[model samples]
Target: MTTSVIAATALDPRTMAAKGAIELRQVRKTYGDVVAVDGLDLSIKPGEFVTLLGPSGSGKTTTMMMVAGFEDHTSGSVLIDGRPVDSLPPRERNLGVVFQNYALFPHMSARENVEFALRMRKVPKAESRERAEAALDRVGLAGLGGRRPRQLSGGQQQRVALARALVFNPAALLLDEPMAALDKRLREHMQEEIKTLQKSLGISVLFVTHDQDEAMAMSDRIVVMKDGRIMQSGPPEEVYNYPLTDWVASFLGDTNLIPATVLERDGNLAVVDLGSLGVGRVRDRGAQGEKYAVSIRPEHLKFRTAPVAENGGTGELTSSTNLGATIRHRLSVGGHDLQLRELSSDAEAPGRRAAGPVHVGWDADKAQLLVLEG
Candidate 1:
């Protein structure tokens, strides 16, 4: 299928507002005795696509609600373009919100629904109609504006909801799992579309999702939250490659966490003792401690015929699973189970199996040394 390019002129000038720069300072939300958000501090630049990523009950949604003016924050301030809007209502905040359910009016046609926000703002009928059609066209739903929510497919309905959000030209867009209802393929397609559209229109977006892959794919910067506080925040690649905590390392992607004791440190490199396995060097960023955990991505582990170097460790290949593009192997090393992933093309033939003794190794530079935390 051919993908259509979104034009710069897709957004109507009258409706389009300047991109928003959002800042949340010491934001905290408490529900009686329980705190949902704790001293959260975040800043999103104008036209930047930032994602709040975490597991359920991590306060991602609550932070978005406070920014959208849907839920009142207990303290701190939410500033859009450097103006505090803590007491402002949702409508007056000029922030577009798209929920997981799409939240479309069942009885209203697509065009009408897209124009509803304009109507509430007292826009003239003729102008509202023109802007609504333009918004629908921008989202590739031009000719289907007359269809109601039930008449459109799930993806189409989602497009209509997005059109409605864009019709008013919000200063910023807040999306809370908008593609959660779609299938995997459709969700991926929508993710690309949203990213393209946001870049073309130069609108700030605060996207909230629990899907790590989706967040990594769409975000310019990712803020990882846990227990109502930020565990780490940085560019997608930086956060994934250098996680500050074990939780962030484990949550962002699959990893092998090996317990080790730091023997010595030399600049950015640290020599660590992996009990019963062997000694290895890893990238350590000034961590002064005896106990540490080494994080290594499964893909980095290479299966060797025998111990190759200082980084090599002997293990028993317990099992292997064929996953089409990749082969996943389970190995037992030093009484701990570790996973090793290799490209299918690089793996042995499907009929051939290597059991018993095996060697696993990774580059010292690729391994991350993290301080063990409670």
Candidate 2:
């Protein structure tokens, strides 16, 4: 049986009345002298899905906790719909939170677990029951409401947790690595489900995760953090394709960073000398200097039939690895090692391995000039 893809559709404006915009102005969180989050200024428009992405101790989770009112910020304010919510309790703020561990009550049935939030809000018992069932249905657990947490699968228990979070019609949702506990395939499936639910409900969401692929898949915008500070924030394509810093470039994915000297600048492009490899033009962001690093994604480099004009280089294939859909090749060019990825369908004539003299080149436009970092 073929599974049909679910496309996220825009919700009606009336249905999204409870959606709230969140803004953090100069938000700072510190434990003694060590800062957890430093002067974070972020704005999440109503119905927007924004992700805080970083490695451990990068302040992504600390920032989320501050927004959820579970942790206090050292300075600054958190505003929801232009109103300050820094002093409000988590329940009073009407924010839904789902943690990495699906914190469902093991003793309670799925429906009761979902209904607990509504009961806390003083919702009528009858109405709470109705809402709980509806929430379960929304999460594809319609008939599983009678099951306990242990009786359900990991993904199902997570759905119950999600149902509990959404049963009260929250203004915004806070997800802290919600898929981290699941296996790889289930994690990917749940990512799509959460994204679909967020979009369908037109609710603003602040998702926190260290997985770059998860952030890229589910977020409308991604905020990359490091050492309690934001390294970069932008649409996934923008942040991935045009990172603002060397750290951002290196952290996001695999890329070949080659040190080169700037030869000339023309408009938005700069000609850089890659020493023995030759000269190439790359996108320049007003970086002034003779020395810079050119970041080129592995997929951008290819085996050229002949020497191209400005961006061609001679390299020897030093290593090759098969990665199912693609072949990863490490090339030694002018004393610098560069990684190249070729489609598996376009594998070299030698079947498994292709290690020998290879003409490696990439289009000048595919490279970006970055300032050398310490």
TM-score of each: 0.96, 0.94
lDDT of 2 by residue, 235-293 (tens): 99999988876778888988999888888889989988888878889988885543578
RMSD of 2: 2.6
The whole-model lDDT of each prediction reads 0.87, 0.85
What C-alpha lDDT does candidate 1 achieve relative to the native structure? 0.87
Lowest lDDT block of 10, candidate 2: 1-10
Off by over 4 Å in 2: 1-18, 287-291, 351-355
lDDT of 1 by residue, 1-374 (tens): 22564443657433343657899999999999999999999999988899999999999999999999989999999998899998899999988899989999999999999999899889999999999888888787879989999999888888888888887878889999999999998888888998988887888899999999999999999999998999999999999999876778999999999998888888889898888768899998775554679999899888877776577688788888989899899889778899999998999876444646788898988899986768
> In candidate 1, which residue ranges exceed 4 Å CA deviation?
1-8, 12-18, 288-291, 351-353
Best by TM-score: 1
Q: Report the Cα RMSD per candidate.
A: 1.9, 2.6
Q: Clashing residue pairs in candidate 2, if any?
A: none
- On a 0 to 1 TM-score scale, where does candidate 2 land against the true structure? 0.94
